[model samples]
Target: MASDRKIYKFDEVVHHNKTKDCWLIINGKVYDVTPFMDDHPGGDEVLLSATGKDATNDFEDVGHSDSARDMMGKYYIGEIDKATVPLKRTYAPPQQAQYNPDKTPEFVIKILQFLVPLLILGLAFAVRHYTKEK
Candidate 1:
């Protein structure tokens, strides 16, 4: 059965991200979701947003009903070539320092913590006085 199914590469899937040519991968299977976009119960945007991408997580995250899962058969186009699928990468901005609350000076944070409530209280009293005068 697997040999009978068409196989698509990652680049080929990425090319179909647009609304008119949407394709998605879920659990190593490629699906052309263009026709089903308008009919999707979750609306077209949900389908379009996953176009030309691996939507396995997105699809599973939604906790789709059994009926929805069953309906996927209609859009099954092929299986992805596992070797061609790109590895997911974590992005870190160059030359940017990560914020660490633990590393921050306690004195500065303490001053900010104290000032915030005082500022809020002062603003509230001012607003109350202004509203009373009106």
Candidate 2:
């Protein structure tokens, strides 16, 4: 059945990433998810997040039910050109922890570290003073 479908290039699919016109590739097949975005059981964000990208892993990782898999036929627009389809899809690199000590002034943090304990102690004393017998 897929052999009869139109073939789309990688560059052609990338152009439809926007919310207004979303497309996704899964297992070398292209799907026009724009119309079904709102009706998606997982909500539009899940579909939107995968727009214009190869979502085969993401889709399979979610463990979609048989019915859900069957429903994909409705959105089937075409198949990605086999010659252009990548064996390994590109993924965003994991974000590095952003705890640069040099980014923040050490003196300001030190001041807060000192003042926080003092403020807590002061609040405790104030509460005690007001609650004490006349």
Candidate 3:
């Protein structure tokens, strides 16, 4: 069981974020991926970029295959101590749109003024052309 696995502090894992000593925390499990860095399809840079931080989101975003997930055990060293990690927030807050009350009405008026005239002119031209002899 993973419960019997070694527990590592996030601070300790952070120190191994180099090319020669890379470690990553993904979904709470720690991986010493240095041995496989050169063989990484996305390259060592991708693995290096996820270092020193909880990379669960980054890992999940890439949508790795089942085999890729299976390969994780090869480098599995331990699990990170969740309590040692500083922030626990999982997802980021949704961004709110800023309503520019000062310019919204003015901008809409200017756009409609230009668009309405163009639309009317286009309609007139089309109607005149269709009604002509040809």
Cα distance off (Å), candidate 1, residue 38: 0.8
lDDT of 2 by residue, 21-74 (tens): 778889889999888865788966687667556788899999999999999999
User: What lDDT score belongs to each candidate, Candidate 1 first?
Assistant: 0.77, 0.78, 0.83
The lDDT-based order of candidates, best leading, equals 3, 2, 1
Instruction: State the local distance difference test value for candidate 2.
Output: 0.78
Residues 93-130, candidate 1: write the lDDT tens digits: 22212443433578788999999999999999999988
The TM-score, computed over Cα atoms with residue i paired to residue i, of candidate 2 is 0.60
Query: Which 10-residue window of candidate 1 scores lowest in summed lDDT?
Result: 89-98
Top-down TM-score ranking: 3, 1, 2
Off by over 4 Å in 3: 1-3, 88-134
Q: Against the correct fold, how does model 1 do in TM-score?
A: 0.62
RMSD values, in order shown: 13.0, 10.4, 13.4
The superposed Cα distance between candidate 2 and the true structure at residue 125, in angstroms, equals 36
> Which of 1 and 3 is ahead in lDDT?
3
Residue 38, candidate 3: alpha-carbon lDDT: 68
Candidate number achieving the greatest lDDT relative to the actual structure? 3
TM-score of each: 0.62, 0.60, 0.63
